[model samples]
Target chain A: MNIHLTDQPIDVAAVLASVQDEGAGAVNTFIGTVRNQSTGRRVVRLDYEAYDAMAVHQMRRVAEQAREKWPMLCQVAIIHRKGRLEIGDVAVVVAVSTPHRADSFAACQYIIDTIKQVVPIWKKEEYEDGSVWVAAHP
Target chain B: MKLKIALFGIAKEIVGSSQLELEAPERQSVADLIAQLRAQYPALNALTSFAVAVNSEYAPEDYCLRENDEIALIPPVSGG
Candidate 1:
């Protein structure tokens, strides 16, 4: 398992490579990208921040949970990027390999969903007028 | 006891610092710490919700805190 919270661009290829396994017959991946618009507003960019130590710790727990929930999973890798990101840039990536496709897909989904809920990371959506922290308010 | 709590995301922004120090009586729960924080930083009360992490793990409201426990204020997470 590999988990990271980085200020630099996320290398999806590297994440996929880290999950490669000869015993694994299937690999599932999820890439989260910064979109051009948010909630009907035009987004210029996004600024992401994280409590690095705790974020990484929570990510590891996500991977662990996936492993426990899916025994067939061979490996898991998650990378989340921080700092300013333009539209279309990758913000996060989750890759999972397993002996079969079903387990890979399930584990990958779980990792991302859990990360969204528990990871100590935040993103500020920058619009032409101003900015707002995503999910900071109802 | 004086405990230092790490702040993240909007919590850091609202407090205007990355970390804060607060005074807590012995065997204080996470709830007490949050109450103190909300009193000092009223802006925290307006957030959707937040969690308290003790020693890098999300702790229950009743979890007792200790000195140098590395507590963190986890504002609503938005990561993927």
Candidate 2:
């Protein structure tokens, strides 16, 4: 249960280390980074906002669901950055540890995927001429 | 009854505020709240989609609303 929503830059190393275990044979991680472009627009940066308490709670729910599916999971950690972020900045990190490599990969993927869909977090892309909230409109 | 809803991301921008206070009928469901909001803020219809969260969980349309429940409008999430 290492879910977090931080305004500061994400500490990927610390997150990975938090899930380390002596008995775990595999550790898997997923890092999401801001891109410089979207569609045809040149993105300068992105502004992320979250429903603070709910976001953290939803993230924890994702971890719990993953653990229930993969009981062998030894540990899980998820961190998402809020506020303005420049291109190439790390936006989110998900790390997990399990006794076997297959379960580690499966659990890690499930956590990130579920968080994307269920977490109450959003990112707005700032372009040279204008800005738009990502996934907000058709 | 009156209910206050927390808005985030695009919902905030459309409403021009992070928090919204609205009048709701008693025994209102999540779907009823959304319908009323859409009537008040037609701009919300432009959004691709959204979900209503009650007490930090993704609530269904039929989910009943309580007076003091923590409610939030969750626009399509893009967080990685």
Candidate 3:
């Protein structure tokens, strides 16, 4: 399990490569991007802020849960960002590897959805006019 | 007996402080501290939608608590 918070975009290929193992037959990844529009408004940029300690901790918890659910899950990698982001910027990444495809897919989705619902990271939506903070990933 | 607890996010901002020491029965869970915090910090009362974690791990509503644990009060998420 790996969880990190950096201002830099996560290297999806690197994450996938690191988790590759001969024993695993399947790998699934979920990448979240900055959407161009929201609530009928065109977004100019986005700023993500996190209680880093708690956010990383929450990501680890998600990995642990996936491991418990499927012991065959070989590895799990979770990366998120904190700071200003523009459209197409990578906001979050989740990857899971297992011996079978089904378990990997199920576990990957569970991890992403759970992190959104439970984690405490907040975002400031920067529009052309102004910005506001609100609960997202519900 | 009582224990020391730490707050974060909007809770810390509302309290105008980072941590607080409150009196509670021994072996109280995270929920207990939250109750006291809500009573003492009126600003936090308005934010009923919150989350908690103990020692950086997400704590469910029924999660048990301990003394000196770094309990975090997390506001709603605004992430991707």
Q: What docking tier does model 3 reach?
A: acceptable
Docking class of 1: high
What tens digits encode model 3's per-residue C-alpha lDDT throughout A1-138?
A: 777888987788987886788889999999999998889888999888787788887788878988998889998998888888999988998888899999999999999998888677877788899765655223
In candidate 2, what are the lDDT values of residues A1-138, reduced to their tens digit?
A: 788999999989999999999989999999999999999899999999988898898899899999899989999999999999999999999999999999999899999989888888899999999999888999
| Each model's DockQ score | 0.85, 0.90, 0.42
Residue B79 C-alpha lDDT in model 1: 78
Report how far residue B11 has shifted in candidate 3, in Å: 4.1
Comparing to the true complex, what docking class would candidate 2 get? high
Where does model 3 exceed 4 Å of error? A136-138, B1-32, B39-43, B46-48, B59-67
Comparison by TM-score, 1 against 3, better one: 1
Best by TM-score: 2
On lDDT, the leading prediction is 2
lDDT of 1 by residue, A9-100 (tens): 88888899999999999999999999999889999999999888888988998899888899888888999999999999999999999999
TM-score of each: 0.96, 0.97, 0.79
Compute the lDDT of residue B42 as modeled in candidate 1: 95
Backbone clashes (count) for model 1? 0
Which should have the higher DockQ, number 1 or number 3?
1
Model 1 lDDT, full chain set: 0.90
